[model samples]
Target: MWFRNLLVYRLTQDISFDAERLEAALAGKPARPCASQELTTYGFVAPFGKGEDAPLVHASQDFLLIAARKEERLLPSSVVKDALKEKVEEIETAQMRKVYKKEREQLKDEIIQAFLPRAFIRRSQTFAAIAPKLGLILVNSASTRRAEDLLSTLREALGSLPVRPLSVKVAPSATLTDWVKAQQAAPDFTVLDECELRDTHEDGGVVRCKRQDLTSDEIQLHLSTGKQVTQLALAWQDKLSFVLDDKLVIKRLRFEDLLTEQAEQDGGDDALAQQDASFTLMMLTFSEFLPALFEALGGEEIPQGI
Candidate 1:
């Protein structure tokens, strides 16, 4: 499956286990529906959506694909508020006494338990690619919180995960601002027409531009006033395009037609074959793109062993 956003993490040490070992560890915590009174549940799931019989881990070359599924009961706060209000009103009117905070809390708890079984279930999945050779884990989530949740689940399943968020020696904001100021990017990368600029001062202003000339005088004026680029769109060697933010998160990632066309030709009509082809192509591209990106950002900061 294609990932639209990435929250990258670095492995502090080599992964000792193979794909089979990882699969067995995950199988111990397979995803299941939330219980009647449980608000949420989380566990590993089949990455290919090929039913329960499918493997939870999908391996290809040096990369491994895994997915985490979370199921949560949908109990709206508005409904609870309305129900609580009505119950409190009824109690107060019938008993001729105000409903105290303690009693109201107990009532709320009872109401929630009563409604939880009837609440609808919402399920979602997060996919991650673990590259053992590269020592990277790329989570397909825009939110850091969600990415961390997946990592926590993985760590629980594996007993331990020696990894941390990817960091660079150089500040990404500085590099991005410099690129825009010079109207040039590092080799193999082309600056695109979208960026987010923010003043460095506390409570300062922010400017977002889209589909406009980044090298124009208007953009230059903002830079002159001490505004720094926090996010910028970039294309890499005609293979991939994505927005790079100050935190080094990759967002709005898109594979160029050149790469996708090749995958399609190789995959034919089989859905599983297509996914495998696309994933292989994507990982191969990242093998090149990520190193170049690190170099451009002044290289990655290696983490100490756990």
Candidate 2:
């Protein structure tokens, strides 16, 4: 919690790619031009330049977050509006739906870049942000100790507004691998042990989950510093499904898919350090998961691999 010298942000990655060709397609441009750049133009920037060899890596930009001693109490909204006008869509910009649909994230990035550079003018010892679009307000020392006060005030100021309020968050500057591992093995890991498997007609052969809003032990185990995860469910369509903190949904996955994503997010393929979505999903399917759970519950075993 020593935030005096630290800076934190919870900025959503913005759209930093071209949408003109896609717009042209929507405007009845030739098929060849549109078809050629289908997936190519939708390229994503690799995190930390890991996939430099991949051709589509051209679509991404390295994150621009920085730690600075805040100098202003309030950011000038006029400044933000002038800079981010292009990012927001109105009736005029709505004509070419493809531009907005395809490049939504890119537009978000531009909006952040246009944010006013200020945090708070109030001397109540609460952290704030100039704009929610830019980075998160991670920590403020001369601020209040109540995290909810800081978050609630910010949300109240902007939640009802058309524009999203800039958020304030606190997180360690660790590698993604460490972050995933910590999440997977947190002390509140009851969700990993208590899972429900019901026979289903779905491709995965069954449904397994614990209700997030049940107001029970199962739901409480996986709660984060915030209710980051509202639900965690798994589905199999020759692949697995995962939703984390109600925000990160990993679907259309296979056994290898989990590891692949883990490798990408964790920044290492140690295999042993598999995170929850992939690790827990692997246990739910390939491991002797069903039988063990039934036995643990003091019920007749459902049969191995059930």
Candidate 3:
């Protein structure tokens, strides 16, 4: 599956487990349904839904895909408080006395406990790739908090999944602005039609442009006034297009062209073959693109002894 956004991280320590051992460990941590009165359950799961027969870890040589699932009961605090208030009012009316504040809070907890079991359950899945080969983990998300949730769950399963956010030598805003001003690309990248520039002020201003000349004198004027490029859209060769943000995250990725060319080259009519081909193409392309992109952003420098 293609990732729409990337939350890139670098592994801080060596991953000792090989594919087989990793798979077995993940199988031992397969996701379980939320129990009654349980707020949430977190664990690993089969990426492609093969159930017990399916390997919890999907390995493609050195690249591994770990799918994490979180099932949570949708019991809103407001709903519980309202129900508790109703119960408190009912008690007051029956006994013809006002309920104490502490007693009301106790009733609130009781209402929440009684409501959780029957609350509707919502399940969410986050798929992250472990490329111990490259010492990297790429989670398909733009939100750092959500990515951290996945990483934390993985850490609990593996006992020590030490990773840090991918860091770059140069600030992305400075690099992107220089690229636009010089009208030169970073290695294999080409400037696309979208960009976002922001003023370097406390109440900073923002400028977003689409389908406009990035190197035009008008755009350059903003750069002259200290408005740095916070986000720049670029295409990596003909394979991928995405916006590079200041936080080193890639967003709004489009792989339609790559997928179409791959589908035609593979010449597959069968659904299963097509699926396999898509995965193959993604693995081949991303393995190359990630390193290049990292270099373009000034390369990664992970800390020692994490």
Candidate 4:
């Protein structure tokens, strides 16, 4: 499946596991429903949602697709507070004494335990593509915290995951600002119409533009006033489009018709086959795109000693 957002990381070491080994490792902490007293539970799940018997790791063309599922009991704080208040009032009235802080704390815990089983379960999944050859792992998460949770779980399952957030020698904000100011981008990258500009000064103002000419005088005016581009929309080689932010996170990723059409032609009628085809195409495309992107940003910042 196509990832909507990319939180890219660079692997520091090579992974040598095959499908079976990786599957067994993931199964060690397979996803399970939250217990009656548990607020949240997280573990690896079948990437294709093909049922419990399906492998948790879906390997294709030396690329591994994995998913981490998190289930949390939805117990709203307001509901808990109202219930606790009622219990506290009831105890005070029936016992003919004011409830103490220690007793109230105990009652709150009891209330939460009683509500846990009846609470609705909110479930979400984070998907990641691990490219061993390219030494990269791209997570489908917009939030860095959520992406780190998935990575932590993966590390626990596999015993180790040597990786760090992808960084480049040049700051992304600087490069983005330069692109908009010059009204030009690196080869194979075209600047789009949407961007977020912010003043370089602390506590300064921010301006967001959508569906407007980024090269126009209006945008130029903002830049002229000491604003820098924090985020910019870009199209890559006519095959992919996305918004790149100062932190190097890619958001609102879309595979263009050029790539999707190729996937459709190669993908067979089978659902699994289609998914596999799409995954392969996406990984291959990123393999090429990321290098060009890094080169455009001055080059990848290799960690010391590696």
TM-score to true structure, per model: 0.97, 0.17, 0.88, 0.96
lDDT of 4 by residue, 1-306 (tens): 888999999998887867788899999988899999999999999988477678898988879999999999999999999999999999889989999999999999999999999999999999999888888999998899999999999899889988899999999999999999999999999999999999989899999999989989999999989899999999998799999999999999999988887887888787887888899999999999999998998899997898
What stretches of model 3 exceed 4 Å from their correct place? 91-101, 263-273, 304-306
Q: For every candidate structure, what is the RMSD over all alpha carbons to the true structure, in angstroms?
A: 1.2, 22.1, 2.5, 1.4
- In angstroms, the error of model 1 at 277 is 0.5
Steric collisions counted per model: 0, 18, 0, 0
Compared with the true structure, all predictions reach lDDT values of 0.93, 0.30, 0.83, 0.92
Candidate 2 lDDT tens digits, 5-79: 112223343322233332222223111211321221111121112332422111112111111111224445575
Output the TM-score of candidate 3.
0.88
Best by lDDT: 1
Measured with C-alpha atoms, the lDDT of residue 68 in candidate 2 is: 16
Best first by TM-score, ranked: 1, 4, 3, 2
Model 2 TM-score, all chains together: 0.17
Q: Which scores higher on TM-score, 2 or 3? A: 3
Candidate 4 residue runs with Cα over 4 Å from true position: none
lDDT (C-alpha) at residue 178 in model 2: 28
The candidate with the higher TM-score, 2 or 4, is 4
Candidate 1 lDDT at 58 equals 92
User: Which of the two candidates, 1 or 3, achieves a greater TM-score against the reference?
Assistant: 1
